[model samples]
Target chain A: MSASGYVQHYSAKVSDIYFIRPIKMFKSRFKFAQTKVAVGALLLLSCLPFAATAASLEAQLSQYAATAKAANPGFAGFSAARGEALHTRNFASGKPDTPACTSCHGKDPRSAGQTLTGKRIEAVALSVSPSRYADPAKVEKWFKRNCNEVIGRECTAQEKGDWLTFVGSR
Target chain B: MKFPTRPVSLGLLVLAFSALVFSRAQAGGGHYYPPVVDPVVKEECGSCHLAFPAAMLPAASWKRMMGELENHFGDNAAVDPALARKITAYLVANAGDAAGQRYSAKLLRGVDAASAPQRITALPQWVREHRKVPDWEWRHKDVRSKANCTACHADAELGYYED
Candidate 1:
């Protein structure tokens, strides 16, 4: 097959499976390398929205709690913890050239700040920033984009629920 | 179905992905994701730094990109059909509204079609979040622009933010 066809076939086939080890290991190391001052600053700034919508944050938190509980009844709480860890973990895959979520957003969700490049990010999980999580489409759009960047795949419903729980707990 | 847990399944997937990438290469391709730089855009617009993400523009916008080549930030880089087609396809496939719709946290809270083009770098909300950093910071000797999202966005290449 042609080169382009090869890539197409490979990506298609891989899509049929789950996460692989080598890819996971490579991602972890890459994540470690990206945690410098500048990138960290960018992460802080990127999470600014969390603070903007504190008013209704409580309601959203409750909703997340319910959703997460329903998604994984046995380990709803543990899954939240795992989701938190996953959010920050970097999967340095070859497809999308970017760092892990933690590379910019700090390991701690409570922190807010700037990035290495000066872009602002909100602490999405910290506050409800009335405007925060207000738009489901926008949230999904970024999740799709960011998930591909960090994990080289889409975030599973379970992962999303876990993430919601962790954010809600915060 | 649940994600593959078996080693054989994982291996098969890897091989499959590799094969897909290779075949894509042989079928009229150079780089898997080649940067589509227009000549005029290169001389004038790119003179400042890298051009904006192609995905920012739609097919209509891409056509505009070609037409405006000569006037691009002041240079002309009209791309031919074949290259443009490939570039356009990639861009459209991953356009801000298209690919981003799947997991954009911002998109999640709002109406389905709320933000037409979800360019995080260009979003007001995003800018407001990072406005405190100061433009000078983004223009650091090493940094590029406030819009040069790839610089700081943890998952820029994937096209959105994870944090």
Candidate 2:
């Protein structure tokens, strides 16, 4: 055979080995691993983003709880029941139009709500909206705005923890 | 054969001029205000309601609104001073009276520059355009507020307000 022909034959073989072998191997590997383990692995992989978000929210709540505990020696642990009451309680001291958190957030936190301007608010329940309270800053911003509008004052650390616990528990 | 250059050229020129005038009229008339483009502006202002187009108000109005965010329409919407400044800059730069915003000229037609109107719904042209909408429609559950432009417009968020 000519030298050029041999070179071309070697290059073709090299290309086939490099390109086709890996794809064939991958297919075979995938087929072999198509079992309960694969399904479990896939499920775990798909759940990662939600897990991260939930963890961050949990960490934020714990941080708030710790702060509340330190702020007052008499402070007890947060109660989801108290949080539910806080969520539904109406105060006349704040804006009359928005005397209760439920005025905008709706009576059921699991259901979607509407703003005074007719904008749709997403459900606040952790089960309904898993992405809720992921960002500490965003959570703080809303708490500041809504607490002032509904209660006419900034919510205490305990109130925030209790509300978050209530929403998450739901 | 003669090409008839003069008449053809004149006809073409007339067609081009008319197209330009028609387009300008469409832009100036009640089409749609351009939607908010800045991410910071969209995030901060859009949380509660649709982030209103800055072109709907004058620079002075946006400045005043940013300055009084603590009492914004009877709600405390105050942001960090630095973020507020950035948002104010974005709104002012694209305000009705801002340069290259000829489309807002009609919206600001009867608006007194000195008054610095805060509500876009309160603008003379806005009120005139919406005069036909009945009182019941305004009070309807779906159409609770004039600020809810998307309630009727459907594509208000995408910057098309054609009825």
Candidate 3:
């Protein structure tokens, strides 16, 4: 992006040295450059909202970590690897229709999934939708519903944390 | 292939009768159901499928369904207790048997609301309305689910059900 901006500025300077029609072309080029610069700024600016949510997401995980510590004296903390296993492994105890998260979410967390009713689910990977887990209420709602469906019970705080970590990294 | 005169005439009679009954059923032949207006209910219920019109079922149906969110048809759709209560209240209030839902009540014509029936699609009146739809239409790739009202009724989200 910066490289394109640099090239735009260089060409603009060269065009400025040329005459009448060149001035009009330079004006258009300058407008084009301005758009690129604004777009680049916007590209960087979009991360600001995600950054704010990133902090809140971390705080949410910390709360879960605290709960896990209370439940187990030797809690080793959340693990992305464990989260991945929990996501992929089919649990016999779970509802027959949804024995694993991958049953509906698919093997690729980065790709979309389809509900039994054929409604499309957005990709779960954080990289795909940076602000997905930003809303604590929505996050908790899905966790409550999905864990019960795929795990046959409410997931432990540790498991929730691990799952979040794994998916957030993706 | 004698033009199947008897069957064709019989089919026409059934069609004409339905046209009259359907008009009476939907109150002047409308296919609309007042969609859920409450944002909370819409969000919590509509996340997975069409937030079906509460007016399509009776109060008993809504009450029964809310009581079993843990096994909602096939998915664990349990919401927060308070939210569930709120949703139930809204649904029951607008249900087919509820006061002022006279038009919606037509859907419950032969149904025993006391049974607390669950499936809206299973409603006898609903079946009658869609009896003409081919099985292949329901199995179409984009129209895969019977829950996908919008697949045929483009304005289903807005409460209109005219195909």
Best by TM-score: 2
Give the 10-residue window scoring lowest on summed lDDT in candidate 1 chain A: A52-61
Could you tell me how far off, in angstroms, the CA of residue A65 lies in candidate 3 after the best superposition?
2.0
Decide which is better by lDDT, 1 or 2.
2
Give lDDT tens digits, candidate 2, residues B1-163: 9999999999999999999998866784457689999998998998789999888899999999999998898888999999998999999999989999865777899898678899899999889889999999999988888888889989888777767
Off by over 4 Å in 3: A1-49, A71-74, B1-28, B102-106, B132-145, B151-154
Q: Candidate 2: DockQ? A: 0.72
- What local lDDT score does residue B36 receive in model 1, on the 0 to 100 scale? 35
| Candidate numbers sorted by lDDT from highest down | 2, 3, 1
Task: For candidate 3, give the lDDT of residue A12.
Answer: 90
lDDT of 1 at B115: 30
Who wins the lDDT comparison?
2
What shift in Å separates residue A7 of candidate 2 from its native position after superposition? 32
Q: List the residue pairs that clash in candidate 2.
A: none
Arranged by DockQ, best first: 2, 3, 1
Give the per-residue lDDT digits (tens) of candidate 2, residues A21-55: 99999998888778767889999987876797788
Model 2, which residues run further than 4 Å from truth?
A1-48, B1-29
Q: What is the TM-score (0 to 1) of candidate 1?
A: 0.34
